[model samples]
Target: MPHVTFIEHNGTAHTVEAVIGKSLMEAAVDNSVPGIDADCGGACACATCHVFVAPEWEAKTGTRNEAEVAMLNFAAEVKPNSRLSCQIEITAAHDGLVVHMPDGQH
Candidate 1:
């Protein structure tokens, strides 16, 4: 299992343990975390799962794929670190990863 820390726009943080190999969007939605809708059901078509990767964890999470990059363009308040959570698969190396939800996601 890997732990993911989701930081809300207001700075509230919720840490949840998730199974490795599952997408980050699944983990957040399963844990009832606010801000991640995962409206497209883990597909790259929707940007509802958009999140900002924490600066320190950016490298670990890696860059977005072409599909994610295109979808992110439609996400609210997109930033350089923006990523679609559905595209982020959890792994042992991703343990303790932190991400921030955008205010508009609600």
Candidate 2:
């Protein structure tokens, strides 16, 4: 399992153990982490799972696919580091990934 860190808008951080091969959105929702709604259920239709990938972890997480990029256009407070959690697949390389949730996601 990989350990994922989710940083909240209030500067709170929650770390959860996520199983590899599952989507980041799935892990967050399963752990009851605040901020990721995943309203589209891992499909690229919704941006409720929007998150900001930590600067240092960006390369490890990789760039967004075309579908995710399009969906992000509808997300609030989009940034250079913005990503949809449903689009991120957990892997060994993402063992310590950290993502920051936007204030509005809650």
Candidate 3:
């Protein structure tokens, strides 16, 4: 498992270990981390699982795919680091990954 940190727009942080191969959205939802609504249940159809990948961890998380970038247009406060959490897979290299939830998501 890789440890992930979810920080709410208001600055609350929840850290948990995510099962290998699981989506980042699943880890956040499983741990009851605030701000990740995940209304589409890990599907790329929804932008409710929006997150801001910390700058330091950006390279490890990878860029958004075509579908993900298209869906992000529907999300509020989209930023350069915005990503659909469901599209991110956990790996050992992401052990210290940190993400920030947008104010809209909260």
Q: Among all windows of ten consecutive residues in candidate 3, which has the lowest summed lDDT?
A: 97-106
Candidate 3 clashes between residue pairs 3 or more apart in a chain or in different chains:
none
lDDT of 1 at 70: 87
lDDT of 2 by residue, 15-63 (tens): 9998899999988999999888888888879899999999999988889
Could you arrange the candidates by TM-score from highest to lowest? 3, 2, 1
Total clashing residue pairs per candidate? Answer: 0, 0, 0
TM-score, cand. 3 vs. native: 0.96
- Model 2 bad stretches (over 4 Å): none
- Candidate ranking under lDDT, highest first, comes to 3, 2, 1
lDDT on C-alpha atoms for all candidate structures? 0.89, 0.89, 0.91
Model 2 pairs in collision: none
Worst 10 residues of 2 by lDDT: 97-106
Please name the candidate that would achieve the greatest lDDT relative to the true structure. 3
Clashes of 2: 0
Candidate 3 residues 1-106, lDDT tens each?
A: 7899999999989999898899999999998987889998987998999999999999999999999999998887999999999999998899989999999752
lDDT of 1 by residue, 1-106 (tens): 8899999989999999977989989889999998888878988998999899989998888899999988888776998999999898899999999999998652
